[model samples]
Target chain A: MSTDSNPITTEAEEKKEEVYEAEHVHKVYDIIAPHFSATRYKPWPIVERFLREMPAGSVGLDVGCGNGKYLGVNPSLFMIGTDRSRGLASIANHEFKHEAHVADALDLPHPPGRFDFAISIAVIHHFSSPERRVQAVRSILATLRTDKENPGRALIYVWALEQKNSRRGWDENSPQDVFVPWVLQKGNKSKQPKEKSQKQAKNLVETEVKATASPSGDSAQTRAACEPEEEKKEAEPNPVYNRYYHLYKQGELGADAVEAGGKVIEAGYEKDNHWAIIIPA
Target chain B: MKLLTANFITCSVKSCQSVTPALSFRDAELAREEIDFSPLFLRNILPRIDWPLLQRTAKELGFPALPETKPELSPIAEGDEEGVGSEEEQKLLKELHSLLLETSVQSGKLVCANCGHEYPISQGIANFLLPNHLV
Candidate 1:
């Protein structure tokens, strides 16, 4: 809610704005749960590698674990995944059979030093302010099980304001605070024969494909291959869910973790995502 | 919905860790167990386990046999190396594994000791979302 025109002023006011923004972000996810989960099937290789390397039966926590994609990386590890969206949590529990709970990222349910390892993927960027993003990271830090022998580590990923394959402009003056759109399927049926509607729907789907073409040829190929035989038949106005995001600049995430009393072990970029490995201080 | 792990849950109302501290499970239902019992896994997990909290949780759940102090990890187990263990160690491992992995609270409410905020576990998933006023 802290727009460019009316900038946030007082600390208390900023905090209040952040709470409203957080609620809005959660609402967006709650609305787009199905659409979001459909496209988020693959696990990022970096996250999979981290989970795979963990000791067997070691307890791990996944904050904002959307669809629980990385929760079942290793069967031996006891992973507890949490997300704000109940729909996504139910999908994770019922479809994937993963252990997940409906919980907030900032105010987590667990105590201090509760988990041996933790992760928050594509989560922090959703916060409207840098301070709330840092607070979210601190929440993860509070749950880490750091001790002498076992120094708990966490991996966090945020969408970078600077992206290589950004179709959307990544100008220096580009607002880090912006709304990204998620186009949903048109639900209402038209007054036409079933076969003709299917053909028209196919044409609309093709038009959609052309309009939203990505820079990557791989995506184009995948989309083209998966097009036919699908029921894209509805003829209705596509709903666009505009979700808020505060994309982090390079080094921004690492600095925030450090500010939250965490030591950055490694910091680097993976595609449009900037990630860091940190041990809670 | 299946119970994952109640080992890490705590009362956040005023940072309360007092008497009746940290919500305890009572008359709960155990629903799911995905991981197989391994003596090595249990031994490796010993140090990470919050002994006092788990013991308190177990007592509240109507299983009062967990020792006051954590049992020593047998040297012969070589759990970190993923080595199998002897029969004697397996018996001990079974007991620990049952307490940690097997027993899961499917449905219950977690009442805070100090402020008395009831965190309900429905559909095998606990809702830990506190209201704005509470925060």
Candidate 2:
């Protein structure tokens, strides 16, 4: 609910942000990983192209590879994926033989300067603080090969705040840090209310509905409009989890990549996400 | 985790960056799953494979000892890009594919050489999320 604009000054503050993200980001994904994975089966074109273009036998890292969707893509390359949420990592491994692990983006397990490439898609934005975001990027970039003749590359994607044409309609004026609600249908196998009591769950959903209906009410209305009529008529309110995201503005991802000791080679807006390809400087 | 994946990963702990021999397996339970063999893929990835590390890992897992030196394969000729190469080369690539791609660590722990941190592996997935103090 709160936005952090000031620079984190102390380790204590940095730890505090980690805790915040653990609550708002990591825990949310753990609870919704299966549902999230179901919706994330498709690989974005740019990401697929990046993987497909890699030379056969090249090894790489998928830093926040949720569901390991991209792991099997271009099987010629050996890609290891890591996710902060164990649930998501488990799904990624179970669904396919691709290697996945539970590891934080800021503290990856891969050896430094070893990978041929790395890709972190829709991952770094979960960091609650700017410093942590840049640190995550730095950690990813550290895993790439820094050879002068064949420098390693990394492709990173983050939700963009400038998606005026998208259904959510966020734009330049929207707050960069916001909580996005993910409505989990009750019948889904993974659906479980965070609150034990039905009354508490109802209260939680009401609060989230009010929050969505307050300023930028279009998202809530649009979601309702798109949902099937049967979903609206359900007796029990579906559990809604709010995930925190720091939507990147134009040029921000490239700037952060550079600040993280990388040179941005390609940067653009794609499908409401800001993506950049960077190599170690 | 694939046996090959172990070659690229080490201790997640920042202080253990200089650790020697990377990570060593402990109580490893391995499984072999069939994967499509591609000679070209093996040939291309051979250079990146840390032969010594791979040898150590293979020995620990009770696999047959690898050759002392890493295998070197000649590049595929232009007209035979899809060919599986000579019989000897084909045999080497298939063995490499079976060892590196098909052989996987089903359950175990990867202990760091320097920090002695134990990263547990279950159902072929490793958990490298360290405790707060280590981070």
Candidate 3:
């Protein structure tokens, strides 16, 4: 909303992003900026699921808000995308960051319980130790709790550490850098999807779970993100037209990830293609 | 809540992130009434905003499918499928303000850009003003 004239100008937006500049803001997102695209980088299904779930007009934080790329979101949420990337701050502004800025997810600068829900996508592994990753999640909730009006429990989604050859972005520099998390809803008896990609045809299925995100109740959802390498390897070379997506397996993250952060509501996918988490503001 | 609450801050944080406040899910909806940007304004704005981020936010905030690139000054002249010099394009843009830029979510926090500060919005306004020491 600032008077920004240069589409590529960082100066104008920089004038607005002076606050919350900390280390690690850019490290987690540096590679993701140019190479990332809402349509190209991540699977559309994950975005679809997020939009179906997260509550609208809630005070929420996108932990790893690399380049501020939200997959697909409901048209009703009040959003402030953050990343450690200070460079991305202006980008967030040029894109209408009502108050987007560069901040450290690991060491947040927020009061306890100030935010409604804290969301970190594909950002956990960036930390050297699992303890740090968990701490960062706690910091976010702490900020969420700072608010006097904060309801109670926080809804956190940690991309359990599932790394496959495909989702690696074809960069082998550091396999441990990125971890993806996805899982079924709580207490759902549905058997976990097989590690091997199954082409078994099934009825077009879509399910919606509407659960309010408060200070209490189901909080965290951990599932290894779907890695795209295996599927891409299985695909014939140079085969264009079909979509390529990462399907996370296991080892992405775990119960400890939540405990490391604090008390949280764990949410995972329950049914096949039917996982939705509603985060209250 | 007042309109300037988010922008009007009393903190010393010099960083933009600190000075600004978090945008609550409520602001995205409430900002609709408080903000009144015109397509003409957004025409000037689109180029300034992060295209991908804005596109996603716009869609989330109720704006319809936006073009891939920043809207050109002569957006209609660019021969958008809406047609160059088309009245429809102009009309649609005017509507965009109400949907994306106009909405103000008061009673939340804005992440500051100057000092990475967190400016709270007690009312509708975002307190962005900074204090002396941190500034």
Winner by DockQ? 2
CA lDDT of each candidate? Answer: 0.71, 0.82, 0.40
Write one digit per residue (lDDT tens) for candidate 3, span B1-135.
222222222222323233333232223434444454344434543442435544545554455777788555554454353332457656656655554555555455644344445655443433333442343
- lDDT string for model 3 (A132-220, tens) is 54565555555554333544334334332232232233222323332221211222122333333111101101011112211111224
Ranking by DockQ: 2, 1, 3
Off by over 4 Å in 2: A1-9, A189-231
Q: Which stretches of candidate 1 lie over 4 Å from their true place?
A: A1-19, A148-150, A169-171, A186-234, B1-4, B17-21, B30-35, B76-84
lDDT of 1 at B68: 68
Report residue A181 deviation for candidate 1 (angstroms): 1.2
Please give, for every candidate in the order listed, the TM-score of chain B alone compared with the true chain B: 0.79, 0.94, 0.46
Instruction: For residue A57, give model 3's deviation from the true position in Å.
Output: 3.0
TM-score of 3: 0.41
CAPRI grade, predicted model 2:
medium
Tens-place lDDT per residue, model 1, A114-200, is: 687999999888876667789899889888877857688999999877764454545445456655555544442222235555445
Ranking of all candidate structures by their TM-score, best first: 2, 1, 3
Ranking of all candidate structures by their lDDT, best first: 2, 1, 3
What total of clashing residue pairs does each candidate reach? Answer: 0, 1, 133
